[model samples]
Target: MSDLILLRHRQIPDLNQLDVYRQHGGFEAFQKAVTTMNPYAVTDEVKDSGLRGRGGAGFPTGLKWTFIDTENWPHYVVANADESEPGTFKDREIMEGNPFQFLEGVALAAYAIEAAEAYVYLRGEFWQIADQLDRQISELEAAGLLGDKLFDTDYSLRIYTHLGAGAYICGEETALLESMEGKLGQPRLRPPFPPSYGLYGKPTVVNNVETLTNVPLIITRGADWYNSIGTEKSTGPKIFSLSGRVNKPGNYELPLGTTFRELIFEHGGGIPDGRQVKAIMAAGASSSLIIANDEALDTPMDYESVPNVGAQLGSASIIVIDDSVSIDWVLRKTLHFFSHESCGKCTPCREGTFWMKHIIDRVHQGEAAWSDVELLNEVALQIKGKCLCALGEFAIEAVTSGIQRFEPDFRAKVSESSDEDELLVESEKA
Candidate 1:
């Protein structure tokens, strides 16, 4: 296996501490970027390294940095630590276990964007992680690694931690910025994206926690070395947060092109109780349910390849489903989460998710007929293209995919209900 970049703390003790991190060549990249390399040069290296966003969208990271409007004075950078996805937990581990590396990446990004100030917007439940990061930031400042005149250069930076009210919508970039500014956490319309107008109407570069953590390594070893690890298109090691029905459910850091079989079977120790794998939710609750066929199991878990199997490798939060679990039950749980977390800012998402939840509940309880199943599918399709943001669209992925791929599960529920109705009628006639 290739060397671990982001999760190096797993091998080294106390890697979270500034001193231990320094011993292992941490902050050397930050020092190099600030003291020697030009700001754009750092961005260029990241672009060359093919380090796309580890966040769901998988946009190119360095290109995002380049999008910062040079004309806009005093730009801002925000590290999105809001890991609200149902099956995603890799970011939390990175922040809690190997913090200095992540903070260094944030520093490098702030410098590249020429931003004097940055923010780490975390989910409310991560208060302990936030507290840890706060103390680490103070340590970096004290050691002259974060504050003004970093490495005696004109580039100065400061990072602050902001907490959300446990709203999943805040995971979206614009909504995160809004929440950071003390507004309702709802996504803003496009065309004036975050790069042009964000965080008090200034050009901002928002990145995922894992995405930022790769920056320090990319700078220290050069883009060529970083590019050599993963596939041509999807270069770099990815932290796959494997969960659900597996014998060993945890984060596994592997190269991007690794197959699903390798992750679920080899690294994850296969399914528990010797049960056969039924479905794979590659991107948490927001994912389209991938039927666990041989082709899909063999499919590469990368941004470009996962779509071939009808799902995105979103955050690589692979939730394995076994034969013991029905697809309808999964849909019910996912719908409930999306419905409850909907920001209610847009009509489509707010109303659509609410109704979807009710329909799925009925279907799951065997209290609805086949017509209800059709209506559930219809509602999901309607909400697909009409939402203001991706939340409404995400709310329907599993619903539509489950209904289409696992229609047998829904049919069985309806069939069971029909048999019950027939028995009741026969008893009444007697």
Candidate 2:
């Protein structure tokens, strides 16, 4: 409770209402920015705050804002609301419970980049949430917080909501831009990145819903205050989506450097029915399987620290795997998800995911030999660096990591004997 920043609205009843939010000091930061501060000043404040993107990559937020090409006309801001990652639902909660705050963050970012229009791109599954956000945007317009020339300034901004057809690939920024523009939702090559060339081929600032939601607070409280809360590199509070096998599973908001042990045992109420946690998936299906030993459990859950445990804190979607749950089964389910979600834009992701899925299915059915396990591992390796986007790379994380770290689980499912036994049989046949 002491370190809570993002989820403080949980304590405030009816905070979703415009008047209630205003009463609780809602758009005051945006107001301050629009009326008094210059655009670069706002961007500089965010830069000084040391806030990193909360959406998986942990990219520096302010640095990203600075990357927007100022010479370009009609700059745009897009909030990446496609929370399609399994076991990750923090963005939905933020939008549902604290819609206005998130919108204000969007507005502040729009102001920073001097963008006239901003869009919140949501997955089709979030239809209701999108509707709610649309109403909130209308309310802001009626209240003079959104639409044309806010707070008697020359600056004007408008926010819109667009729904995707549930393509998980659209979560990638360039792909998201492509989908928004009525094109196929496949990733565009980088370095003509979103900053220099984005949405409609103009400079755009595309940030996560959770990332934009932090901006108002950074502006209001000052950069030093935000910086003081989290670890040196990974600053500010993060809402870790806790799911699977935990007693009380939900979003637990804490500072960046909080340990996995505290998140699981304390906030999550530990494993249900006294089952031992065999492994911890730090970032949903995309995470490398982390062995749930005391050493790993004690490791702090931050962008800097989680990597020490052989996994990235990607999106911080912590899915606990108790001993009762076999890692092979987890891999099977994860592979199936990636296979189904593959955009088919490139060969590695398109064909690689399909091939890996069949291999995983065979292994899961106990119909594969020990060599098939090697083949599965090899296929994942082949797909590792040859993809068009992070989805392809993420597709192999659980497969390779599961086989390497939890070999016993995969080995148990194979019909054949050990490699030595198979070699002996081959020699006898010869």
Candidate 3:
């Protein structure tokens, strides 16, 4: 098996150019999907391939498509390009470097789901990316690969790149849809999943950039061939976005069952400055903090195996932290991010994330109580399972894990608070 799939295209220089992408077999999947196969066949092929969402949710991509409401005509496919999660940058690379492949993936998905239109919703900060994608879409239209009577198969579609106004909540599929519709970016309640209903009350399939990128290849290679790459359950190569403290911190694409030790030591060149491994944020800042003991580091990076190490393989974004870094500071950094990105829609996430930041900020400044750490941990728990989206749920994972798994670090900060006058000032801020 190869060490990479999506990252394999790194050698194809001028990757973003339509001509370069075409020369490299970029649009082959779109041609294959529209010309030879039916939509149900495409969905079935994906299901047979065992492809799952590369986004944080990890839902089965084929199953998600099959679940869409057929009663709702003119379905939509929204490619989520809001790569806002800390320690997760794989999608950015795919969109920025191998854009045509991703666009082909979107077109293939549209043909599969019978969607008339698709939208590439990008984070507002990704205007340059949006521009490139827009030009790519135009090129596809000119080439007769997209638009009325696409590939002459009675399928018509257009993909528009919509820019989101810098909100982390927009990374959530439904929230991304809402933002694309020009509303505020806030998650909606979900029993009416995007499949059943989404984007102007139409059946929508909102997939991550990486997830859709896999579609074109799966169609071209056949399901069984694609399914054979990774483990039985996690049947594909995944790009692990490795960052922080490592000698070569970057995206590494490898099979799912690959071990963390291999990812860090062999692929990532181990920790820099020969520092001892202190913690592993297995799935970016949205995961439970795992103390980097040999057992945890040796655990394989897969859906089932990672959780055994007390963390999730979320988005497969592995962030390595060394001895020089403090858990409290890391939690504080995450808290600050969530707090700043909170859409202020729901009470728990809106009030709770900000509350967490205030407490973590106080702790960082050495003006906290031993009890305050426990309070902050409890607050994170309070917000879990109660908010409108995964953002609220995963937002608290790091903070709660840090306080529970590394209490001494959190408690020691409180002890550094010198006088009662300092405590009073801290109390006022809280």
Candidate 4:
């Protein structure tokens, strides 16, 4: 009903400026949290708001804040700003357009968790954005909004920005922690989760950019008000990054329960040249291929409803595939990306992804027999449950789902003849 909260800068001019942002009530929520409400009370309000993480996990944001170890001294908060996933670029836009709001969200979270220091871990490619944020952080500190003894209170806070070496594996929390520590970027074994052991062996709260961007408003508006926007299970507005085949592809912020038809047709302006959509990759390159039909088009694009169509609403990066596209080519592109980005920490993922890439490449090149498709599918299943982190598992999503939802495409790409026939063709070419 109301205009955008995270993207309010679109309606107001000069919002990126600290003075202009202050004119629009910027940093007021952080001030209220630090001055009026206790830390735990702030956490409780977020829990009551029904806000979930927008970093593909969909975990409760407040619940994560509550997990911070109060016993630990000098807690840290890390904002995941590595927008490496294909078809996912909403975070970069927020940082570029409505920056102060996002920084304010980071500050609010620090107050709630009582973190003395916070860091924005950005990708190496975001050098310009990180530099801009550095200047902004300095502005906030100079304004007495980010430095020690804020608002005449004893609580002190500082925010910093760190850049990763453009590694997609660093997008994972533990991997990000490892990278921040100047080590290799790979995921750590769980059990001692980030809340207990993280970022230099101290309790840390690692949240995504969009997830934190919701904090300021949740604190300003009552939980009841935020909860009334979306469905009972999945509340609040969601920023859907629309890409691929649509005429007007970009970010469209809508309620969580909006349908695929609405996102692709109404917001995205439908497929270009009046082409029919054949499949939907609902969460960028990491999502399973959802058959685009009446049922899928009507399916609600919420965390709870997306799984009914065999995929999670991970980050809501919807990629629309037209009927003119082939599923084999899509899987080839996705597999190549995953294999290249894999950290090679685990055998199944490391080996399976390499093997899948070769098989898919051969199939794409029209040099492989039909059996290669079956072998590729089997290899993807083998790598599903046996990865060091999500990189490997995510690598196989398009492969398995592409094969399942569009078997004809895979079958048509490879030769129908036996392996001997393929070998003879290869020999003749040689």
Q: What lDDT does the true structure give each of the candidates? A: 0.92, 0.90, 0.86, 0.91
Query: What is the per-residue lDDT of model 4 for residues 266-369, given as tens digits with 9 covering 90 to 100?
Result: 98989998799999998899999999999999999999999999998999999999999999899889988988888989999888989898888888887777
- Minimum summed lDDT over a 10-residue window in model 1 is located at 421-430
- Candidate 3 — number of clashing residue pairs? 0
Give the per-residue lDDT of model 1 (tens digit) for 28-95. 99998998989999999999999999989999999999999989877999999999999999999999
Misplaced by over 4 Å in model 2 are 418-430
Stretches of candidate 3 above 4 Å error? 1-3, 416-426
* Model 2: per-residue Cα lDDT over 257-343, one tens digit each: 999999999999999998999999998889999999999999999998998989999899999999998888998899899999999
In candidate 4, how many Å is residue 205 off? Answer: 0.3
- Pairs in clash, predicted candidate 1: none
User: TM per model?
Assistant: 0.96, 0.96, 0.96, 0.97
User: Model 3 residue 117 lDDT?
Assistant: 91
**Top candidate, metric TM-score:** 4
On TM-score, who's better, 1 or 4?
Answer: 4
Which pairs of residues clash in candidate 4, taking residues 3 or more apart in a chain or in different chains?
Answer: none
Model 4 TM: 0.97
